[model samples]
Target: MGRKLWLTTSAAVLLWTGAAQAQDAATAQTDQQDEATTLGEVVVTAERRTSNLQETAVAATVLSGESLDDRGVFSLEQLQFVAPSTTVQNYGQGNFFNVRGIGKSEATTAIGVGVTTYRDGVPVFPGYFQTEPYYDIGGVELLRGPQGTFAGTNATGGAVFITSRNPDFTGVNGYVMGQAGNYDNLKFQGAINLPISDTFAARFAFNSEQRSSFHDITGPYSGAPGDIDMNSVRASFLWMPTDALRVLLKVDYNSLDFGGYPADPALATNDPFEITANGPHSGKDETARVSLNVSYVLDNGITLRSITGYQDGISVFSTDLDGTSALNNTFYDRVEEEVWSQEFNIVSPDNQRLTWLVGAFWQQDKVTFPVTTFPEGAYHVGFPEGVLDYYIFGETPKETKAVFGQISYDISDRLQIQLGARWSESTSRNENVYTTYPAFGLTLLQNDEVTAEKTTGKLSLNYKVDDNNFLYGFVATGFKMGGLNAPNFYVPASSFGPEDVVDYEIGWKSTMFGGRVRTQVGAYYMTYEGFQVIVGDPAVPLFSSIVNVADETVLMGLEASAQARINDWTVDVGAALSKSELGEFYAADPRIARSGTCNAETGPASPNCLNLDGNTQGYAPEFTFNIGVQYDVHLPNGATLSPRMDYAHIAESWTSIFNNEALGDRLEARNLVNLLLSYKTDNWTLAGYVHNATDQTYIAAINAGLRYAGPPRQFGVNLTRTF
Candidate 1:
């Protein structure tokens, strides 16, 4: 009923406004309704080639740098609210990012994520370091559904593409911005671009932000959780020896201290903003990444490109498992990861009748724990806990390689056919051991390797109804590799297979009222086999392991978005409605370790094991919608004043398949509102904004078997100037 009402309201508003505008346009127009102002066309670069968004058949959300600033989006965590069918959940130790109801679900390295994220055409590290702020960005593209052909492995649900600004051979230029707000929040941002020669240029950008903790800890904690302090910078150099050859190099560094991730037990009834923790807080994450892009154009209009990337990141985090001020009730996790990757691509000219692209990718990832060489006092992670409990030691390394290609043929002027495929192989090895204090004992757990290979592809047919309307449909397949799990907590160590998915999607795009309005509507049905979920004691993830279900899961959804630009006002609306159901599966609640397993003859071992045959996927709400309206008021002095309002609604969703209300297993629906007012001149602009204007308290994520509260209301003012 809620979904129906939301869609009905959206349709009614569009119809009424469109009709009224049409009547006004008819009185002074040609054969078609004409308007003085029209929406600008957006060009998407996620497809390995640049193309107008309105002409592309893929389901995507594109945001420009200015758009992100106008919408008050400073980090990746806030992106979920603006994009349909997207969810970004932040936990104490890590995060879960899902699109179309599939993504990370456990704290383990034995499996792969369903969604893949890329930066500057290179697939970067996932799961950690996601809180890094966005600065000097060119644009971002969120592609929904399987993107296996383009992204290769680890893409079952969707993909994210982020591109930062590149240096040009233009003259020296840059900008600076500073902000101050409530909660002692302060931010500084700036950039500088310089031209070294006629063929070489460089650009540097930096961001630094600090804010007070939202939590009031009553326990003797050694750190401040729920606080924010981070700094990030980037440098890029572009070299163009000739018109046919170009090379770009980018170096990025980040130093982030989130204070810590404050969380309370899922069953806790205390104020969400208050916490009691006895453990030491550790939230220090740092990373360094470099990418090189080189491209050359041939006389035949073919382009050859090679991209090389390297990244190293270390994350240290601590949490209170009990969410209370209990003695010796702390958990600490510290790790480091290094990755090296290379990709090569060949592309035909975009204007050709037969456009095609072929690419190859290779990457090696090494993740390790700081244990063996260092002693108890050095790391402190599992110090007293190591004596009481035990900690896992060693490393998990993986190597992946893939070859992918896509081709599109023009069947006629109004119709086209597209086909794409990818063959991927991943190999992973676990050389880990379980150990207690040296005084206690040590045991070798698992020293093994696993390999998985898959071939995924897609087929699409697009038809142009006219210059103003288009239709498209496609079928695609996606895959995610699997690995081995070390035995722990009385749970046996086992290997899990890869997850697979087949997606069928159809869409329509149209422009009406002489480009004054644009709309995109789409529907998708997907069936993915072997849904993965963590099964074990939730209190102690050391005992938890990612496992696969026996049957295939089904998901079906509808997505729609509309944008309009009148003489002085711009309006945008996006909505998504999806129904997801898990296949036949059953797992005894991890919280209740004493419960027996379920079986057909025995009926049920425990209430939690009763059947998950038709349960909804966790964190996947049935309906989501967002709307934004901004009016630009012109002044006689050649300046502008703009006022904007943005609102979003996310329906209630379950934290787990069990859906036990008594345990607070469900997240309540939330309504978010934001407002911004801006005053702009030729060379300078000032803005004041407020987010979460309602000041509602809600949980944004569930980790460490506890709930993490979302941010509260915040108001701020910022000023920017151009040189």
Candidate 2:
């Protein structure tokens, strides 16, 4: 099936090329007039300095505002399909992200993150909060590989940077959109810019959407609509005090309410869009953030910037864990987090022989997490009917401080060498307490404090072959500070050390055929130490623990992407191939340990261990790729028509670290295709789209012994007006 799909896609590309060539010859003059409208130059700030993406040495992907709208991407979940080397998996509680085969999938509250997500230059808390919706944005940049020099914290994998549209002081402008789709979906969005004075401007944007559930529930308890309700707003104020100075203040808020997991108990016998869960199930998430940014140009042609940000968020959910009508198991979990951060940076003038940037960052994060479980009915099978509720409460406070600097030296005019380093210190204090209801007495209490410090750096050399081509090579190191684990039953370990990785890469970027075709190809190798993984505790079958597997792991991959403007058609193609090797390691789970050498109490085993030597990393597909094409047709009335198609495929991969076949941990490869058709006038746009046009049946995620199916085929229409 995979081979056939690839062949079909290739044939389509050939057909499109032939058609485009024929049209180009007939409209040669017209084509020349449109030649100036190729893919625009992509500018990125991955290294704390603004530079053309093709000129940067780092491996990264940039999605412009137009691309985001064309793909109908509003969340990180949709972004996974747009980038071949990145994967975002939902684990019930929230989404887990991975880039280049390095990341964690568990939804733990107090653990450190591998990939850091930032909004407008400010880092956000823990991984789950990274799921916020994307709207009124300028661009989304995904920096692959390690980004430790400037990112400073929890950047072993990479980073995602989101840029919001800024307020315009020249005039007033805005747009409004209304959308209706299948499944009783309705959405509205609007944004407006107001010029308050000669030097100050304000912009406000908002979105409200609601959709009925796609799953049909059939169980003992009342069924649910599985609806999706979300509202978000953002306000920005920009002040230009002088020609060399500017200040910006922005505040954003979002609220989301949804039916619980759209999942089935077992993948083997359940329908793709049917669930048989019982009891009340739902979830809500609220978030608010305020940020201030000031930038001033020095007399020496340098720039100094300062950013201050504060965020407060809370997420609460209740679900039927067992996914059955029987009241056997249910749970309620809540996470409240607060973060405050400040950063200062000094950037040297661009195009200079010696370009440098220095920065200092400080952040404080506090989180309160708690979970309660209820047991009832014959769900326990022979247990007493009157079972007490169990509760777990935890509080984690963390602080981080760092200083980093990077310098790039131009050797002659064709070769440049860049070097950077960062020193970071972090402290974590955590407390966990467990108790059972009815008695309201504590069963256990645990506390731990940990402090860690690390120094990381980057070195790169880039060579410009010509105006349209460049070759680069670089080596970078990334780090993630580790901390204590929640004190649950039979957990003997209290703390873990930081996880780190070193990455090496070489790549080429080029634009050929007179700017008609642009391509980027790269190869990378990464060596990881102290890989963090979540697994069932050896001493307790039901409890989970996060531990750093004591072994050296290696990952290597190849990435290629191309964009072409052939006549009236635009084509984008990307492919990624990667492999991971987890070194031989002992299993902490006693149940998986070998015979008599395992210790029963601590389960630390005396030489007896279960080796997972040759397993692939969880959710890391060996091969993934995407292809998209869109064509523009001019109408006699001076309007324009566009039709587009996109296809993405994910190769087979394991969802479980252990690759446990007995538990059905393997997921099969799947393919999806989307279609879009739109008509545009000078001030209005009307569009319709079909997502998952083939109604592909695939497992989107597997966690806590359940499988979640991807959304089925659905179609929608949107109308927009610009003022």
Per-model TM-score on C-alpha atoms: 0.94, 0.91
Candidate 1, residues 16-89, lDDT tens digits: the string is: 46644684463455533343467778878777888888778899888888888887778878888888888878
Say which candidate scores most in lDDT. Answer: 1
Worst 10 residues of 2 by lDDT: 376-385
- What local lDDT does model 2 show for residue 261? 65
Looking at candidate 2, what is the lDDT of residue 259? 63
Model 2 alpha-carbon miss at residue 80, Å: 0.7
Clash totals, every prediction: 0, 2
Error of 2 at 692 (Å): 0.6
What would the per-residue lDDT of candidate 2 be over residues 191-309, giving only the tens digit for each residue? 99999999999999998999888788887543343688989999999999798999999999999877666565644566857776665566677899999999999999899999999
In candidate 1 the C-alpha lDDT for residue 356 amounts to: 97
- As a whole number from 0 to 100, the lDDT of residue 487 in candidate 1 is 65
For candidate 2, what is the lDDT? 0.77
